[model samples]
Target: MNKLIFLLFFAVTSCTTFSRYSPHNKMESCVEGYYCIVNDSLHLKYETLGGFYFANNLKEYRKIKVKNKPKFKNIIFYGKSNILDTDYYLILNNEIYPKNFYFKETVINNKKITIALNSNTNGTYNKDFILNFRLPK
Candidate 1:
């Protein structure tokens, strides 16, 4: 009887953590070198430092950790530039979506990294976003 009650409680709590509005499980499931921001029904993930850089979404909001987020930003093809190792410059681009509903470049401060991004998500909803995160030197 005691075991059954414990199991029931565990299951209920587990399901609650996966909810989109769940805040407790937000930082609880992040890996050592990654950070995540929960938006509406999307989980945008960023890495502190790694081989690849950029935040992306390809799955429903969940607490499970994926090895790497997809390549959402391409600074080389879109801007005709090179990406550096110290920082990341990204622009969200898509034509299928209407204006003001896709992705855009948020101003990145040079407190942590020193790179450039020639963002061109103009006339879209990409300019209304901003992300600020600092890594320890």
Candidate 2:
């Protein structure tokens, strides 16, 4: 009976589960201007930007300006290649912003990408946020 109880406790307490979006491995290297986070055993890597550009069409890239320079734009992206259908959040001024912005994925590599938010607003840019990523257990 004691052994059974111990086994049950071990199974319940020793089992570790990772977050839904956790990375497969720990973030070995982070960019100079970036930070990482682990939530529920998931790695979330992100960075903050003052402003960015967006192209209306994916085939043709065009630069559009915005009026209100975002106080800060939080970017959360994947660290691995062949990632599909990943959900990330972009926070601006501590508030969740819309997802109408455009993103450009690098064809040569899957390391990084540029996102343009609020193409209609124009002003000074200020970035203040650490990019975080979740790591798999």
Candidate 3:
């Protein structure tokens, strides 16, 4: 009887915990070197980085190299010449995204770097949205 009660309790607890985690609703966003997740939805909206530079000019853009991970849906580059006013171009699955932004002239020793972007999603221009990027080795 004791064993039966314990099993019943365990089953109920396990089901409840498992139901909270959903693989189908995850949301992922990758900027620079950082990847952000919302839930389980895979479609991530990307934004361009304005005024981002390496040395004297903007850092050139590059292809995303993700290993042991799912393929990205889109990539874009917003040139610094426009700076805070330029919009990013969408790079679709079949198309290649160009690396036109300038990187700091200094040698990048890290494998990844995170960058934050201004958030206008709320229509009030809140400064909370951050875009993270992963730099290549």
Candidate 4:
């Protein structure tokens, strides 16, 4: 009985299996700025190169993990990219999200854009956040 209880305790204590998301500014061998993303806090360093473009498995909230329960996911995405250039473009449609959260290039255009998210991560939501600005005409 003691051995069984020990095993159960180990399993419960090791249940930090939640997803993570973090974005940083980086350049892809070019002078232009690009978003460097990291997913899964438990991922090995070898698997973090080039970063990810779309990460929709982030755990926005904290919760206890129970046996056989659904996994926690996190979400963090980089800016848009152009085929001809490595620089990423992002129209800050949501001022709530920090403009310096990651690398993003602003264009002189006026069209509004949005990125829709469809995920099953618990407590994780893709809300409508808009950030609109324009350059000198």
Candidate 5:
């Protein structure tokens, strides 16, 4: 009787957990150096970065790390101008096009990166929305 009850309980819990979060079981795409997930439901991509250097002074670079993991359904393309070690990077968000957003300040706390973007009057980003990004591992 004890064995029967234990098996029933285990089966019920396992079914509930699996039903709550359905698995995609889709294959991931790793072409060239970029990794992507494309299916009928969602699409996301990840690209390795070289660096983001200032055009005026190539000697200095913007210390920014691209998150290697994709958690949302968005098309992200991260790459440098050239394959050279001194290449610079530029991130473009398709949601907010026409106008561009620049990095005002960046804070690293508890292994997480929080980027504060400079206000662009012509941009579509709302002032109330806070942008938080995860660093590359």
Candidate 6:
């Protein structure tokens, strides 16, 4: 009985007391200031190379393991790419989601853009949050 109780306690604490995002960034060869997560609080690190894009459309790819339940305001994404003023799609779980899917606001300046993530308004906490952007030509 004591052993079972200890195991249950360990499971519950492990899940609740820690973040779901990974602490390690996996994209080792990303072009500097191009495809990466900028915020420090989100604690998201790519577990895989995520995905690749065609030469025509340079997609930013990231497959981060969900280590913690993210705070709505803390989820910020800063990106720099060629398609600045064009529409962008956030591809999650092999589906196309809007840029504002989990965004509270987005500010674009030149080739840089900052996206502030919102609460669970449009997306949910899953095993992994895939960052695959579909930018227009």
| TM-score on alpha carbons, each prediction | 0.19, 0.23, 0.21, 0.23, 0.21, 0.25
Error of 5 at 125 (Å): 22
What TM-score quantifies how close candidate 5 is to the native fold? 0.21
- Against the true structure, candidate 4 reaches a TM-score of 0.23
Which of 1 and 3 is the better model by lDDT?
1
What RMSD does each model have against the real structure?
16.6, 16.9, 17.6, 15.7, 16.7, 15.0
Number of the predicted model whose TM-score against the real structure is largest: 6
Error of 1 at 124 (Å): 33
Model 2 lDDT per residue over 5-115, tens place = 999999976642222233332332244543333322222333333122212121112123234223223332222111221122332122333565333322112233233
Off by over 4 Å in 3: 18-21, 25-29, 38-137
Q: Write the per-residue lDDT of candidate 4 for residues 18-124, one digit (tens) a residue.
A: 22223432223211232222223322111111322432222321222123332212222322212222212232243333332332233223422222222221221
* CA lDDT of each prediction against the hidden true structure: 0.29, 0.30, 0.28, 0.27, 0.27, 0.28
Scored against the true structure, residue 49 in model 4 reaches a CA lDDT of: 18
Better of 3 and 4 by lDDT: 3
Stretches of candidate 2 off by over 4 Å are 20-23, 26-31, 35-45, 48-137
The 10-residue segment with the lowest total lDDT in model 6: 54-63
Lowest summed lDDT across 10 adjacent residues in model 3 is found at 54-63
Query: Once superposed on the true structure, which residue ranges of model 5 sit more than 4 Å away at CA?
Result: 3-9, 12-23, 28-31, 42-137
Candidate 1, 33-111: lDDT as tens digits? 4443322322333323222233222232111224533222222111111222122233323122223233333333311
- The positional error of residue 15 in candidate 1, measured at the CA in angstroms, is 43
TM for candidate 3 is: 0.21
lDDT of 3 by residue, 1-137 (tens): 99999999999655421112123322233456333333223233323232332111111333221131211222222212233432222222213222532121111232121222222222222223222222312
Candidate 3, residue 36: how far the Cα is off, in Å: 3.7
